[model samples]
Target: MEVLALLCIVSVAFTGLTRGAGLLPDGPLNAAVGEEVMFTTTLAPTEIPFISVAWTFGDKPIITSNVENLTEPEYEGRITFFTSTGYLQLRNLSFNDSGEYRVTIVPRGEQQKTGTTRLDIYAPVSNVVVASNTTDLAEFNSTVRLSCSSSGSSLSVLWLNGSSEVTESDRVQLTDGNFTLTILNVSRFDQGPFRCHVFNPVSNGTSDPVNLSISLSVSNVVVASNTTDLAEFNSTVRLSCSSSGSSLSVLWLNGSSEVTESDRVQLTDGNFTLTILNVSRFDQGPFRCHVFNPVSNGTSDPVNLSISYGPENINLTKSPSQEYFEEGTDISLICSAVSRPAALFYWFLNGDKLSDTGSELRLMNIQISHSGNYSCQAFNPRTLRDETSQPSVVSVLERISGSSVTPSTNLPIEGKSVNLSCEAAGSGSRMWMKDGSYLILADNIALYDNNRVLSFRPLTKTDSGEYSCNISNPVSSDGASYNMVVNYGPENVQIAGPSEIRVGETLTLTCSAESTPSARYNWTLDGAEIHNSSVFTKDNTGLSDSSNYTCHAMNNITGRTSSAVHELSVTAIPAQTSGCSAGCIAGIVVACVVVCAAAAAAGGGYYIYTRKKRAKSTGDEGQDNTAYSGSQELNYADLMSFQSKDGVTVQLGSQNNSSKDARDRVDNSRPATSSPPTYDVHMQRMRSAAQPDANGAQIYAQIRNS
Candidate 1:
């Protein structure tokens, strides 16, 4: 038995040694679907050669090799082996190919070596879907079940709210490898976007988010006043109502009656507030708010509204009211009112407030200055209310007992009539005086109306004086004086100045006028007014400036004017002889001498020419006359006469060749009684000469001597 046991032990040892040959993967040897997987076997180093090496997937042989590689039909194109290392690679692995892979090696002399490896083939989770039983989630009223599905092997399912994993809780149950989540009593807190995640060894995938929404219904309503304490008349008030949940409708009610919106009442802020404008006593009431939703309704408790008002029907009265009273009279004024709260009193005079605070206003002593309108006001301080009374007028009159002289005009124009009246309180005799002297009436001054009126027909400067009117009554004697003023025009107007003025000479003219009031002067050139002063000055007079100048004196107070006119003649300046040069003066003198010499020479030339011509013309006539005269020794005057065709006589004088005895005898024989021919006759002889030269010598000599 020992020897047999030894042989069995040896056999067992041999099997163990052969089985020690195993496969080693690079890592865990996991692969996704459609990927490659490898299995390899290592034999102890030996001189013996292997008979065959084989690889199988699960229980099926996929590749076998000895000198070369061989693959089964199932893995023919997808399997490869390294003959030198006995390593096998499988390509395009599927999920069904996931399992243990074994490889066997047979050496020439050693025991056969085999290796096994586990290959996990995974298909990444695909076609993932998350579905919920219901999309609508209700607060505290619904449960939601969600499921996740995918078409992949070895998948793990997870629930996610965004990127965070969904934590497990009492209300949340997860089953089916966490592929399904059950939420109990879904609430607003549970409402969110949920997602399902599926993962495998190779990859992970997530489904689209599924959102949950929560619905709610109205729960409670609250209504309150914006101002809870008090509401006043004619004041604005507001009430607000609110609800617990969304999508709620609200309404306001006043003591079970629905309130309607009007001009004075309005609903605002999406029907959350009820506003009452200009609140009155009728607006006070108990108000409530009602709110409703599709599933529930709620109502708020009533809130009471109270309003306050005061002080009405106010009036004022005067004690012993009268339109007019005498001085030293007393008057009383009273103010009254009807109000919930007693009203305070205030007195006003001519719209001015007085210091008196009582209801009665008393005037102890009235005077003329106190004649004015009076009024009173009643006010309620608590309610801020007030009322005013109509104004009452009071007048105080005085007796008219003093004497006064009233003139028709205080400023009477000169030469205008004025009437002065004397007044007395009672019937009395009246007398007038001038300047504190007894008055005497003249034709221009007359007294009328029982000597009470003093009339001046035409007022004068002397009429401007103090005049008094004296009156005697049964009870008194009085007098009044008036300072009368007579306004007179600008009169006696005169202007003083030189009538003739030279160019480049300064001229001044002064205007004066006599009047009651000093007059302002306006100087006018021609018809146009020029200056406003009493004196007018011209620094340099120009020839063209000569004009009719007038001065107008005006009394501005009396609106009277007087004017004076004067003619101004401006002469040109004399030529300046000192400014002329000696050459210029000599040239002027030479021109004058030349003119005179030229005239004299013309006279002499004409004299000679005419004398010669006359001598020749008279030669024939003289010869004829001499021949006639020789017969009778005719007198020279008679011989000189010659009858012309026009019946004019011509006398021929002795020629220069005439003998001196003949000329002397002619001169000595002339009758002394014959006055020398008158000057007119002489002139006629000169003018009658047919030829100018015939008389030129004699006329020239005569003109020269004369």
Candidate 2:
């Protein structure tokens, strides 16, 4: 029943409907986005007399039943509707006009509909062009940002890098509602027309082409130290540079030649800074700073550094007294010099400079030929100057014979007690030996005095060597040889371990050794090497780091290696049992002391117990011995203390040997003077005094006063 009622209503509304004529479009139109186009449809009467037509769009009435006309905003002033043929014309067509148009007509109170058509508005087709910072000979691997714009909307962008067109990608972005385009990461090949096309359903548009220009030039260059002239082999200089605007590096060149790697010249930072730590006369030259860019070449003017220098003071001297000596005796001449510009030294004999191409002038094996006047001179090229010293005269001496040295039959085990004697064939009264380069005269070795037999006690290795003596004035000298040896201790050692050890954790180690004196050590992990460190440690087992490490006791002087290695290992109680933390550390100290005591008692019988036991056990004992050794180094401290015999204290060790024993050991034939011999000469000379002349100027004229 509902369906029948709906059908009746629809029929009543169409009851007066009749077919009518209306105008409509048959094709599409073209125009720019902002421009407008018109589309029109008209209504007309059909098969009716004395009747009028009404125009209506869709279901809305646009004109009265007796009238026929139509117009739209998109076609205002450009659209017209006619009733005769029912024709309509649209003047402007815009994007918004692209829709269907409908027209309705009515005659004699009867309605009719007939018009229906479609409209499409479009803009004309055109082309766009794109460009970059450069085109021909573009910079390689450059960061170039590109852009493109057109006169139309709804456009797409296309880029051509050289021969290849870049597809729209993440690196390229479109903005301004797709009217403008941008490209990033432009390379050398990215140089060409980029196209921008604007299009819609009707037409397409494009822009003209643009070219790019890129530059690759070097920048940021500098030099170190202002250019200046300096002395050859006496000055230093440096140069440096950096680059910007391009990744191309800069190189340092000396003239047209490239500088090679050398001790004096250095290059760093992509061939930027050229450093000359030191300069020499031969190193003086023109230097160039050059830059090389991928697109271009750059260079700086040449800078020159000049050098000049010269030599200064020269001096000559003779060793030994310049006094009289026998013919055929040996003599020495030494030449020394200082220079301002640093000069070469040359020796001259009798005013004639030696041309042997060597600095020294030596006269081998004394002969009459060696007796002459000699001088030396130093010359400098930089200063163009030379200097000469006063001449020196040399003389020779004759040889003398005698029993110069007496051998020491008994050698001291602890490096003490030695003897030396010289019997001169010419009856020389005194003797001396060369210590280092200087001569030391001694009357007696035990007591170094002016006039006494020579005997040396508590001798060191340095005491060994040749000795010469003279018996009387003008007597020939005699010579002999002797040898002394000594023994020393250890040095250079490192100790490492926990400041405090916990109980039962295991793994505690203490190691030490001798170095320079070439020594080995006994290790004590918790307490002692060769003994259990568990006495204080909670664990009985030794840590890998712990052991009796002996820098095997070595005496550099004796050059002897230790016979045994010291090893130590220990086990510790758990921290809970040992009061673990603080208690464990205390236990360690007690254990060390106990072990030390045990070592001391065992090494030497308790009856002979001395610090030697301490020295043998703890490394500190060696230090004590060293202190004592330094103090006890000399056997005789006071050489002139005959009155207070006890005044001379030998510190190396306790001196129990009496002076009487020293005297008894001495030869009875040798004069044993408790008071040492001395040479004291006093003489007086008388002379006349001169009186001044009337001028009172202290005249040089011959005058005398009584």
Candidate 3:
């Protein structure tokens, strides 16, 4: 927008300058040599889509539509004309290109409009040089003529004594449009160090200064140094000046201020050499030597002295705030120093050199071994000096992991010592919990190993619960739980059942015992094994199913067993006494023995037998035989049932001759193997097989318990 606005302003100004002549004003548009100039015309949008356009410089055509070779040969590659807006750009401008430009635009259905602009070119002022007729002039005795010259057209010259313009005066005279300056009746004040400033319409130029002094011309005033390698406060150096002149006095300067002699600074060799015994950093300067004799003086070019300094005031800082960092984290430490030529940094850990050689030391994925006192030493390679910073302690801690509570015995026995220790891979505090609550220590519960281990001395059944151990540090926390169970006895063993029931009713005897692991149950009837489960059931009970049923419970861990006894009896209903007028009713006690013989088949034959031993029946043989008089009594037990693999249960009935007498007790044991062995067996403790007779009837055989 700024560039377009400038073009618009130039167009408006050109239009105003040529409003009367119906011509275009191209320049008095000032442009520098080798630069381009633009001619802009404020032409309204063509109402009729004009096609006829032409441009000319004076009488010769420069460019025209549908015309070949019409552009002047000199302006072939340097001119561009936009027929639509009547704009023109002339490049690589020279003085010979100054002329009048004409553009004619012919719009459709309208007559042609002609715009004319005049161009004038000027050269840039350059190479301005001011000179004196004679440089050797006494300040109070000789006069000087200073002339200025430059290369440019329509140029003006201005003489300057320092920054003030040298105007016409009685002592200073200017001629040829101030191109000539004459300083007459010269004095020390008239010894002018002057300049010539020349400029034209295009550009301006200034000449280097020229000085006129008295006595002799001081030339080649150079400052030489004894040595450039000077250390701060450690080496002595000298700065001397040499120039060709006679009767010249010497002056010295450090930067803009003059250097004077003092205790450390000495002037030797006729004040030409400025020496200092101790070359401090401040003494190294852009020093200059000036030689003058009352009216003229020459100073050499600035010569700077280089001095090496120190690596001092070393400092080191750490991040992230230098607090405890967890393993696998990162930290950075930076070392800094105030020194000349930038100090070289060397990092150290516990007074040992590190491989890192920069200003910063970054420890990534830090571990426990990375934690230590860290310091930084800055070395001045030039001064051969080193300074160390105060050691910064960096602490990296291990993260809490693998935290768990391990019991000395996962399942400890009751009334025994047990220790629950909390362990982790990292350093952290340990805490113990019971179930989900903080454990309250009692006489039996205590802590050891800095509370890492929990001791439960003489553990009881109450100690069986869920316990958790939590280990934690500033970085992380973890916990593990242990479900504890204390082994105890099968105490308070008991059995519940009806003491008497009908012969066809069910006699259910359930036995239980208090123990950590469930106790194994055994049911016995009249000292014979009746069942081996917690609940013993006998359906269709008979008179023979009467006697002591004992339950034995045991804990494998405690190696202890306890038993309880239950006596149950089954009785038969008496037959109705309908013998009224039917005299002499006989009380018949008939005993039909049904013997249970072991049987086995290749495809799982069923056998029902009781393990009642005959020894028990022999002891009560007299009572059993007397109670059922006139009938033979057999007090033999039998296996009454067996279950096949297909879940088919076969029940066998045994008719035993029983007597209601305390002395008539029988003892049964576990079933024994049958006499004949079968090839394919499905029973865990199968018995021998008993073959059938010729009439396809089963033969009876007794199985005595061992």
Candidate 4:
């Protein structure tokens, strides 16, 4: 009856019996249970307000007006009415709610209009499951039936083996709307994990997997061995077999015969492993393993064993084994031995092993140094043994000729370019050595022409050396030597001397310079040549020595000269001193010395005082100023201590330079010490001394005894 109602409703929707046109797509609309559905009307635009809107499901009203409680009791809270658009929606619908639905809209001044559609609700596919009629199945004997079941309405079912849909044929059949599958006379290929899919107009579902457990037989089998190589009496071996399927057992075989257990041979791991101890040469066999069950049997591939033995009776042979070979000849030597595994070989020259590792050694372009006792050694890694052959003697002969070194020029000057080339009569390699050591290349030095030439740009003094060129080949070797000289600078000339020295002390000065081919020295005073040696000395320095001295240096090869100057000042050492100032000295008369001589007769008092004596220079060519010497560094000399009657102690130091005579008192204002001392010798500032000769005049009275 429900189906008949849905059919009638669908016929009314598709036909032109519905009132509104262009409303919604014509339908018996399909919906699943527990889902929502909506209906909208096609009330044409009228520019008039809607006076009434109504919706109905079958004969019962779902929504009619805003003030009426006319909605179906089951749809009370599930219905929504849009009065302006004349649309209706229902939520959480059930299978019983499927029927004809209609919506009516009444404009203020027009006749009522209506839209009608059919809503068909279906239950969603759910809870799908698959089951097999029988669990135990066998190939060629058993049958299988797979059944699919689910809960839903208006559903269709399908059978699948893996991902492909299952179809009926001679051994297969699908019954009951494809909800059941059956296979007769099942083969091993018919073992399957099968699934079923069920679908309705609104939904679809798939069931979990089900499978037939058909009894299987053996198919693939393989054998593995412990070792392919076995020593004759020093090894053991194991072989194992493996196969697929159930209820399986293993068997061992050598060729075609069944293997039995013995003291030396045994089977373990359910006869899958065959072990042989103290393996012998006769034990080498092509072995096989067999796997079998009640319904099937299989054999593994054969495994062959190889027995290992010895390296012995070693011998070596030489090709072109002549006693003597010319230099640059080729030779080959081959070594052999009786070995189970082929032996590796090495060559020896005079008992020292060469780098060759194969059974053969080849020497190309041999040199005289290759002449020696030649031999070979053989080693077997399997047997762990070694054998050496008897030695064969070889000799090579050759000669070296015409080796020489030539320079770019006969004379090399410092700060100039030069190169040296080395060559021999034949083709060979050349190396350059200096002073018994390899020549080191520096920023100014370079090598070219396969190291046959050495060059120096802006050659320096360091480049001078005894150089040797060594040329050599397999034929022979020869070397040539040379002595090179570079002429360089007479520069940075320096003189070592004190700038001032006391008269009567030796005044010495020495000069030096940086030069190659040793420098010559010359000394000059005031631009006049005085000496031609590196050192100059004056045993008795006089005032004339107070002048600039020069030392000159010359490099003969480079022909350059340079000079440095030294200034030497000579000062005289003064005599002793007493407390009498020059003031006291000039005032006392020579008659006082006479009076002192007269006092010897009376012994009234000691002579008054002894004046401090001053050493004077009269006619020095480098004459300094006038009546008194300037504050020179020599003033501290000739100090004399004097004490007056009141115990007053004073140091009187001589301060004078003569104008062919004596002159002034001490110049107190001028500092007399060379260093910055706290105090100085000051004059008493008595009445000024008597002015003395600017022209050979004397100031002090010289007392004479006749």
Candidate 5:
């Protein structure tokens, strides 16, 4: 009956439906495989009665209900309907059941209503697989093509490296609806356990892991030596080889022959080392090393070995093998050795190192001090080894050419003796020669000590000559000569000076003598020693200096003396006089006498008058005046008498009557005058002494009296 009602409802169109009923899904009707879906219908209030409810799948009935539910044969166990609410439920849906589903309602008194909705179903993805074109990858030299597959539709595939999505880059490509991943020029960085992820709207799945491995090739093989390959004998050395790869196998070779480990040879660092112990000459050659792997192989360049030895068999040779050499001759010595490397030479003299380095040693202008036992040493610088040679004896002979002749004294006196000695070396016979001839002894000549000493009693002019000493030996003969000199005394003595000289003139006299040795001179005047020099000078010559000057030259060497005399005459200078003559002095004396006489007469008259006046003024003195005047006259007489005797004038005066007596007591007392004397009295005295009869004293007396 419910099916009949659904068919009747689907055949009859419900027109002019008044907002009475509707249908809606509880959630989206899109479904996945094995998921359930529900469709519900709603009714509005109306004056109608509920008749039936039905659900269909793409024009086919899925379920119907009036009072109970009924299902189609296709959805018999999968579909159900609610009787009170008119809701439909589909269980375990699949993609084939995807279509439009409808719900219809029939009312008894109102218009019937029908509603529709869509149903979408999808299957869950499963059984995913990700595969690569190649599993074994060579880094940077290969490509990989990866594909992802699944059993679901409308799916998305993604590549993942250990849970991280692989991004698309220049080395990665995607194709075929994200089902394929292509990796171009893959490197070691691309190595991974990769997986493919497939997803759909309802479910997702991951493929099994695909592990990628990169194969790296071996390259850049290099070999090195720990120390310098130049090894000395009995020394050890090591060589090493290296490469840039994994799982490496190393091999060593010596000149194309494989080298194996032995007691003295070792391999270390996984067969990469070649160690040679106590190296010998046989171990010196080219060596090689090889490195290989499963991917590639490499060979190292050859390493050459060097070995060194010692210096041995040292020998020394001299250029001249003679017994002896001259003191000033040049000589050479050479040294050699048998060594692997050329040796350095060192010279030694008398077991002392000379600090010289060379193969040959040269001595220039050798002296007697250079004589010694000489030797040399040969050394190897690299091996630090040396060898010494035997010493050689050197003798420097004293030849006869070294003989000499010597004089006992350089300077010989004329009457003194001298000796000439001859000297020679090596017990040689000697002889004396004078002036290149054999000496024949004369009267005063003598020879002693096998003619080596020639003596002269007195050295004379004949004794001065070249004396030669000759030496004759069994090995050599030579001679040496000397010149002897004899000294003499002063000869040809002479004097030099001016024969005549004037007063106040300078005089120079030089005396010299000719002698082998210079002579000293002595000068004398009037037979008395005056100077002891060869030259004499006398300035301002006077008459007292006039004498016979004698010079004596004496030789200090021979003690001999000689003399010469030169007479020096000195002229006298006349006395100078003034213009005044003796006659003018006489006239001056006469004038002085006349003035004195007048002064005396005037003084006498004045005295007489003064005495008279004094007597008249005092009253009773006329008689006294006569007496005083008379006494004054007597005093004047005495003064005139003394003046005439002594050639000097005097004056008198009286303070009282006793003045005349005082005047007589002082006879020498006289008054001085302001004027100079008319004539010099001391000169007058000299003239009077010189000429006793000239009357100079008498004239002075006359002038004083006057």
Candidate 6:
């Protein structure tokens, strides 16, 4: 007994040692970046001061305890341990240090034991920003710059446009981490908001986006002329620049650089003035007035300088205020302007500049395409800038036949009225002119109806005309002549049939028109020749043989026609079945016949016996058969009765009779076809199939009959 007790205690101790290994004292260890943490173990007296202190990440030892080498790039300054202290310390922790660190102690001949600690590092995110110049509307092509930046350690910067990151190009420049975005030459295409974001491994943050708009503004310096128009090669030009304020320091650039003195170019008090000794095409180009002002350091819109060439005294004479041009006819525009240096001659249609040797712009053979907003800009070398006249709208009028003006081409009854209107191609404003000349006072036409509207109220034949509508404004005038045909037909015409009717009875058709002078009515069947069908005669009545009718009305003077169509139906009684041929005798015969019918009722009793055998042999059960116990038989009887009353006999055969019956012809003449042979056959089949034969007698009967 004493030996057994000692053995049991030993066994218990072995069990605990095997099961509880590495369970306690193995919890996860944690630390953060740039911080020092240590793990320690005990040592015996006289233990070598150089005892191994193994360093590792997870299960892999980055530095073996036996190597004793400390000056490695990855672990050099990041880790350290004292010989006597029996402690391991990690310094300046980084992201790579975020893992398990373990050390093994192997004091001479003793079993080795191990312990672990984990290191974690956290670093903050970098910064970002978006930048653009602050202004709208710059010159067509020029240089501009945008920039982005961030503030963080070991930083990286990214540039974003909307949602995508953009790369740098020759015209687009980017800096190191500074993220400077440059647009070499700015145009309308380079307008948008830019965003900047800042992030690092530790944390992330972003900056607000900078919105930019670009536009065009006159440069600091420009040349102008006191005279209305500039002449070619000979004109006095005045040069000017900002005398003070923001653009005061702006320097003038001629062509591409600062304007210095040439024989023809002179500057008085820094006001740029250029005198062309001889006016020629070589001097015509864009002149630059560059401003070096610190406040407005960027480039300004360049001023274009040109020489004048066009007909002189370019005056336009138009009657009917705004004259409508007709193609293939002669029309003229007299351009005239006085000049110290007589202007060269050219002609233009619309804004299209045309060249001519003489002073007048004449179209000997005009065309429809020539119609447009026409204006003239004149310039000469003596004048600094060109002058442009107000635009004149020239319409090439070509009248074609079959052009009619009505309030509407298609209109709903009672929804539209006959209002004759003028379709004139000119400014939409209207004014009155008597016959051909002199303006009519505003009072002559009703204020509500002032816009060339000829309303026909109870319209008469005299309303038609060649009336003219004249439109004018201070700048121009126009006129339109129209032949107003006051046309209207029967409106709100109703042809109602009699409400009460007997089968094959006739109904009267009354055609009434709610129109002026009561439009004349003509009746027709379908869409055939019309007939008056005298009012006293009952010719428009609805009869059994009559087709659908239509009533048309026409206005005699206006010659406008309108019609309404209506379906005429005669009433008749539906056919009901007479009593069955033999009354109750037939019904009794049908019932008796059903009692002896062949039945194909389901074999639930057999299904139950078979199911039981299957369940017993398989050692399982699915369900018990329950049939023909309640309403099933009644359902079978009801189905037979319905088939009897409807005279439908259902029969069973090798080939389904249902498929064959579906191909039978349908009787269109009679509402119902002749009755099938008898309902007795269907009833007999139902009754005979309802009974069960224990010996399969029905199968034997079918075989014998076949």
lDDT per model, in order?
0.70, 0.47, 0.71, 0.72, 0.70, 0.48
Ten residues in sequence with the least summed lDDT for candidate 2: 678-687
Query: Candidate 5's error at 295, in angstroms?
Result: 5.3
Error of 1 at 466 (Å): 99
Candidate 1 minimal-lDDT segment of 10 residues: 606-615
Residue pairs with clashing backbones, model 4: none
TM value for model 2: 0.24
Specify the highest-lDDT model's number: 4
**Which residue pairs does candidate 3 place in steric collision?**
24-116, 528-668, 608-639, 609-638, 609-639, 609-640, 610-638, 610-639, 674-687, 674-688
What is candidate 3's TM-score against the reference? Answer: 0.31
**Candidate 6: tens digits of C-alpha lDDT, residues 1-706:** 6577456534533442321132113324444456665654333223354446566677665555544644346676666665553466777776677766666654443355555554545555544555555444354555556666655444466666666675787676777554677666555556555666555545456666665454444343444433323445565444454422232344556467566556666666545344444333434435555544332343445555565543234454433245576567666665455553655444555667766534456667767787787665554445443445566677775543222234533221232345556455434456433345543333222323556665444344444345566655443456666554444456677777754453324457777765544588888876675567413124323234345678887766445677776665654433222122333223333433343342222111100000001011112222221232232111111111112223343322122333323322122232322222224533444454323332233323332242
RMSD of each: 31.8, 41.1, 25.5, 19.2, 41.0, 27.2
lDDT tens digits by residue: candidate 5, 1-706: 6676555445433331323223454333667788897775554333333687777777788777666667778887886666555667889888788877777877665465677777778787989998788877667878988888898767888889887999788889888877888899888777778899998777889999998766677788998986655555558889889888766788888888888888989998789888988665456657878887645678998887777765666787777866467667778888888777798889999999997789999888877677889999988887777889998766554567567877788777777888888887644678788898898889888988987788898787677788888887544678889887666767677778888886657899999887667888999887789999999898867777888999998887678888888888897533222123454344434534554565555453111111111111113422223332321222211122223223344332212444434323432333322222123432443353222223434545544454
For every model in order, what is the number of clashing pairs?
A: 1, 65, 10, 0, 0, 57
Candidate 3 residue runs with Cα over 4 Å from true position: 1-318, 328-394, 434-436, 440-442, 525-528, 539-547, 567-706
Residues 108-162, model 2: lDDT tens digits? 4445545555455555445444444444343644455555544444444544444
Off by over 4 Å in 6: 1-120, 128-468, 471-483, 486-493, 501-509, 512-518, 523-550, 555-706
Which window of ten consecutive residues has the lowest lDDT sum in model 3? Answer: 582-591
Worst 10 residues of 5 by lDDT: 607-616
Instruction: Write one digit per residue (lDDT tens) for candidate 1, span 1-706.
Output: 6577456535544554333233444334678888786665443333334688877767788877777767788877887776666667788988788777777777654466666667788886788898988876556778999999998888888788767789789898998779889999887767668999888888789899998766576766888787644534557889999888755678888887888899989998888899988665445678889887544678998887776644555676766667666667888988887644677888888899989987898988888777787887887777677778888887666543678999998778888999999987655678888998899777789999998999999988778889999886433467899989888979999989999986547889999999877999999986787899999998857777798889999997789889999889898633212222334333333333343354445442111101100011123321223222221222212122233334443333334533432322233332333222234433444453333342434423332332
Better of 1 and 6 by lDDT: 1
Question: Quick one: best TM-score, which candidate?
Answer: 4
TM-score-wise, the better of 4 and 6 is 4
Give one digit per residue, the lDDT tens place, for model 3 in 103-142. Answer: 7766554466677766778788888999888876765567
Order by TM-score, highest first: 4, 3, 5, 1, 6, 2
